[model samples]
Target: MSLYGKGFMIWQLARCENGNGVEVARVARAAGLSHVLIKIADGPYTYNVDRTTRVDLVPPVVQELKKNRIQAWGWHYVYGSNPVGEAQIAAQRVNELGLDGYVIDAEVEYKQPGREQAAKAFMAELRKRIPNTPVALCSYRFPVLHPQLPWKAFLDYCDYNMPQVYWQAAHNPADQLRRCVNEFKNLAPYRPIMPTGPVYSAGGWVPTESEMVEFLDAVREHNLSSVNFFAWDYGRKGLIALWNKIAAYPHPIGPQPADIPEQYFSLLNANKPAAIANLYTDDAVHITASKTVQGKEAIQTWHKNFLTNSFPNATFEITSVSGTGSTRSFTWKGVSPSRGKIENGNDTIGLIDGKIAYHYKYFKIT
Candidate 1:
């Protein structure tokens, strides 16, 4: 059977509530997560030994997770400065702690001179010590963005590719996850991809509960083995509702529908008012901020005037799409010379017989 499970990565053990390992394990199990990845080390010397708790937290966390029948894996960040030292530290920790698996988090520091050789040295030393342990390479989601990082060198020695597919600054989780997996497959050897999504709210942007569900759905649609979120502390404290919703979400059972938002936006961008109107039923109604237009003819006329006269160079971009059955809601943005810029654009489309029967749009122009 496929390893279809939900998991979360913890950046630091001390960050957990009161630095309690049992509490951490209970929270994870309560969230329906089957596994947890805790940071055991950073660089060559900084072990995640909790300062406030004044104890090594990894063993207790692992022990608690094991008691709960949840897999506990350890991860370490490699700075690529002292490859042998980093590898030795990682190997020694893994051996001492006996984790279910290990993850190598290599980032910007690896994208420097002699990076490939450094990665090779690290992986060689790591494998020499723990030859049979399952290891994964976790790094930037898009290989194109970090071409200098020795992706091949590290992945060749690792067992899985755990890309940090944090959909920050954008809400299109399905599209972004799809693109991330496709890009990695094209560049590296085929490996099971267990992508990590975002839960933390930073820079005035936070993901909604619905969007998080859509991300899990996207992972299931791709037939991936597993899905994980970034950090545990932020999620438990800041996004409690979203966290509960994720735990309660049921596993998708069937194939997902074809992506229709792309086509809908395509028609809008093409300035084909008639073609766009044809996507709706003959008895369809369009609702806007200023007025409501009933019947397909009236809707067609309204679109024609806006597309041909008002916003001739308008372009629509969809950030998120969600819903089930016949109702769907999409968040978008429109740019045009006439309107200057349309932000916070939202549309709710109700379908009947595979055609739009009710459409409502709202936006703010600046």
Candidate 2:
């Protein structure tokens, strides 16, 4: 739900609507925003908190956004200096805010000499605390340009990739976005790309309304799920015309239920058993040709064993899907490195409040 349609990123919530939660939500709804991302933490400290007043600025906005049927995602700028501390603060903000999703904003500092271990540490800790919540890695658009950013480390846990495709001085947004997508598609532990376009002015370089449209057009041309505008405060104040243009864009703004199976397949490909298990209800049941398993912990163990031992380094692909109401039927195939392959796989799932309550699988190795 967080990665569907148009999204707006609010760098400083207090700067917008004079810190009025209701007004901020009203603006998001007026602009037809599907999701609003707010900065929750910076480094190892909680952001958007009044240092002197001792007030948390996010809960009200998050609450109001939900009332408006909009997703509220929290973003944090992480420095590799204290990965564990950062992870602790991020997870704390997420749970306390009741966010729909979380984004890890790892940038220049992450490209240091040795942040791979730090990246691994941060993600491991964060996932343990909020395994089921959808996580995204927000970073530079072109992965080739920034090889040292530990793309695999953070992406292994991320459900989406929100690239900062900010065409600051250049007008070639379409080409840059295309290049960004191509570079990311080749990365392992792949996550769906959701681009972030530039909406603010910088150093006398302001993106034209046409450029914003082209950026969004490129998002659709590349079959991306959604597009986000950076610094909502700047966009609303300085680029009202561009903001209006984005609001009028014809992209259908909402999540599709049919995407559930593909999302599950993505997690399978990411090789995260904890995440896969979290997608199910606590009392969920999964049945296979060999045996049946119930409870989330059992499901996690089953997948951990199956994915790690039986089908280590396997790629799962959905062949087809058909469903009605709460029930879905799908076919998938998995090819493993040393264990050969599983084919003709068919499965049925029953969703309860967006979490899988029942799953039945049938497959054969050939």
Candidate 3:
């Protein structure tokens, strides 16, 4: 059974530039996404216009999206201190654009003094006109709930509260999700929660598919109505992989793999390393390993090295595997000939020819 509704973050993607209904539809269909929240702009009051001359895209991508049966939402980039004059324009645009709902991305600092009143007024007026169309509010931390903050007032006006519970550079993601569920459960009972996770960042590190799966598992565990990614590019592969997986499951949510210490690690070892190397069916990946191996030769040599060095002599037990379908991870722990006894360490492995294709290890010296 489908999740009934699936959601994704749009804007700034190469696909967005294409602006063709067919391309958009193909991606949505492939990812099992039914709803797309198009990000119109970047930060505090910076609208993503086609050239600042035309704020909306030509021919309205929303119509194309809806044609493919994808519900579309308009995200207004706003800050606490921005002028109300622009707010009216934004409200008018939402109605004209025929968007299903509005996402108020609060990128400004609201805790500072003398900022709450303006923010409240803006949200109230916007809500007053678009009463039927749901409003999704975005905020960063618990600070958005401060007495000095207008989040409460905004919440009263909006339909749902979408807290950006992204743990990219903050605390560990697992810990962060658990804490967020507890906090939201107590504070926003009436509001349906849609937590946004970090799929990508400017830091250039893209999350693997399995890490994305873990995030989705968190969303399901918390019983959130839906989950959204931060931006278009970051860890986008993982986000799409997650959507495909959810589309397969009978229930959209599942149990978090907390009790199982090696649940993630074990999958790594079970992977067909040979097949992993040839994941990109269309293009060939240029791989260079530390042991002067490339392509198929590199993959086989690495696994062989591992078996010769660690297995039999030591307990070569797989610890966890974190990543999506083809692009997965393999973590193993035991005594090795290179060192003495080991606890938790990982060797990045890839597949080739239905077996292990590539394997390399990273080290963090203490």
Candidate 4:
């Protein structure tokens, strides 16, 4: 029941105008979701966007979700009519009702000039009206929008970036999710990324429960903070079924395997450093050859020194490696990097990244 990183949003599927808005909130909460995104309904079947609606319907939904321990927010979708007005209205509603935040879904012209400035101005006006409300933006992926897109221009006025990464379901969704999160982080390393993942595709390919769990597992694997599903409803039966299946997953994917090579010899033969430093905390320490290295720098220096001294001209060949969370172990046979085939027995234990945390020379000469 610890809902820290999981989030769900209702876009057009459940409208406030309809009597089912309250029930929709119940369903979202029952499914172990911590966030409920209510897409403001301006279309038919929803009550008019007015102060009365805010007082009667909107705030009640927010409170209802809160009662079930779910953080509620308003996501205003903007298109041809210009989103600034709806953004203002939603922000006012959230502010009056004391909700968590607001999301501005902008469908912008990716090829237009001065579009960044226009987006910034819209965000600035929305912020001015909302004052203290946390603002977020939904935009296309970096590759689609160009690497030099005005992310900063919009991010400066907003709090988070929700890039829509609706890639096909492949072998490892987590790796893809990590890559996407990293790309956004590379754009603005300080800001958080809320990637939008699709549960079901338009072609009717619904990801299996294991696959959906794998997607979330991939998110956790990369230490990503949060995620958003592509949509609320589109008459897709598989999506609801998939959500139910994901809810049925015994546990949210816990700590995932570390992204490191299995053996030291493989890394060395591949021209890779025996140890990398940044993958650990600043104060991380390791015991190598019965000698405790205080920090990453010390560990790196020690690892390089030992390998060079023990096997002056040896090459490494990885045997096997596997681990989850922070603990990992690997074994390798050393050979001459230049020579085709000489073997040396020097086993190495790596931590986190490919850093040699502990090393022992099994045989002095082979």
Candidate 5:
């Protein structure tokens, strides 16, 4: 199915407009949304059946969304630890709810050892039960950052890729969305990416109205068919203005130079100091907080001695990137055994002929 249109994910039906299905539907319709993905199940046995409502809220919620001409899909948070049990419960809930579609919310738990086989088992079981329900895998936005997850295994059987592109601790939704879509497209068994942007605030950080609008704009500009928000409850309560802005944003469709910074981080995470050095010119200079290293050989030695060895398990996650063409700046967070935690690290790179000519790195360890 071609999943196109604006949508919101419903975490708890009971929390929506005081458990009034009609009110919830009215709110969704007012928001100009076309679909609602409701949380139906979590893990093997937990169903989001609100006891206070005294009704199997899924049916009523789905009915209301459908009544408002909004497609209603069910989402299940799969643990992947008990593949068979999780699949059985998810398939049973999907069948019982009679949802228009289903989404598997797989996360870090699925990144454990033997995850590929476990994901296959879950998918196989789910397919055996549903036979023909549209299923999608919803997980991390960056495929490169999560190499352990069984992305191909789950996506191979799924119909769509709904990545949770939550730009947490950052504000550049457009850039992040573009990178998210691009990275997923590079993977095998690629499916249509319908990203879920963050609406709820985390750690005192909430996306602004302008950022939400830019997110929709980026989605449309990328020729992506659909876009969805992370939530409805928090949005309706705290982000009404942002919510309305997104609803009114013109998302009519149509149509990467950041690879060097990306490759630097990737190589750094891989502990390939020599490979990272290769990205720079022979006389490239790397300026740190205390000292500077000039020449490729010196830079390689610095990375091997200070960058890699100092933190064996250190990984740099690019939070945001800015600037035009050759000169670019990026913000990142890193964690390692030696550093413990590094936050708000900034890097400026001057690229010549797609190779780093000069680089400056600054950060604080906490």
Candidate 6:
């Protein structure tokens, strides 16, 4: 959920290297993309499923992206017709794919009368399934333009807003983008904005390479931590000029971890054992299945050996966390190259004077 830097949306799986997951991941990694939003569900049904073979096409891409250390998010386009069905499909696909984030792409359909209640129902049902997953609302760039899209109903449950600031048939990306940010800030229950810009062409008109630069500059000027493009199928392989322009732009990273638990998990993903051990006090003790280690140096060595020998090139993700004043309990999962998958990782830690004093961990890697 802590998405940062540049990302691109993938609309059609087959269009990109004939739906080869490894190829898609290689493309994303080469572009230095922090995340890739793959289409997961459309209305009440799942997307990216092979019609003839009846096999889900999303998991391969999701697996490949995660292996490359890039966040693979799922996006759904909703019509608010069958809120429950849509919500169920949303939950099913997100859980099945183990997505890093979920995006609700609600558009003009929610603007119709009597759709606000539907939005509420959809979000409530969706939350019941994946309560810990980060969700976002990707809708119109300007809420003022579409006043009846149930923005509050969706935004209340969302962790971020990614407005589609396409600015189609126009060259004023900076002006339009700035205005988009200003408007969203005033909306009720405003979430962190990670606006999406146009990388594809509409009709015969295309966004000039300079216009893309202007848009990125405007996003950086607003100090937003992240930015994304609309479509990979459209511009990434189609238009080299715009793609290169976006590549050179240094999209800023997200803020630091907010808490001790977050910092610890982040260190695990960063694969820095010494830095991770620094979070504990000098006399801290770590309890595990094999042995109990005391002191920072021992703790560091243990983690280093674990990372190197057990799960090399692995990324750990905290699935859920709960805690009190000086104690915390968290569940995590990890994935790595060479088919390493960790599903059940439960840990509890006791903090003393803002530093870890006692840590107990239980996990299985298969």
Write the residue-wise lDDT of candidate 2 on 124-144 in tens digits. Answer: 999999999999999999998
TM-scores for every candidate against the unseen true structure: 0.67, 0.74, 0.59, 0.60, 0.68, 0.70
- In model 6, the worst 10-residue window by lDDT is 250-259
Q: Candidate 1 clashing pairs?
A: none
Residue pairs with clashing backbones, model 5: 221-255
Better of 4 and 6 by TM-score: 6
For residues 209-295, could you state the per-residue lDDT of candidate 4 as single tens digits?
676778777766655566667555631243677677655544342333324543333345444333444443455565544566666
Local distance difference test scores for all models? 0.82, 0.88, 0.56, 0.56, 0.83, 0.87
Question: Model 6, range 1-366, lDDT digits (tens) per residue?
Answer: 588889998898888767899998998888779999999999998898988998888899999999999999999999998999999999999998999999999998899999999999999999998899999999999899999889999988989999999999989999998788767755766577899998887799899988998999988776677788888888657887787888777776667335677789878888899999999999999999988999999999999988888888898866556555788887788997975889988899999988999999999889
CA shift of 65, model 6, Å: 0.9
- Kindly provide the TM-score of model 2 when superposed on the true structure, using C-alpha atoms: 0.74
Which pairs of residues have clashing backbones in candidate 2? none
Instruction: Return the lDDT, model 2, position 37.
Output: 95
Write the candidate numbers in order of decreasing TM-score.
2, 6, 5, 1, 4, 3
State residue 183's C-alpha deviation in candidate 1, in Å: 0.6
Model 2: residues with Cα > 4 Å off, grouped in runs: 255-366
Clashing pairs in 4: 17-46, 174-218, 265-316, 265-317, 266-318, 315-335
State how far residue 139 of model 2 sits from its true place (Å): 0.3
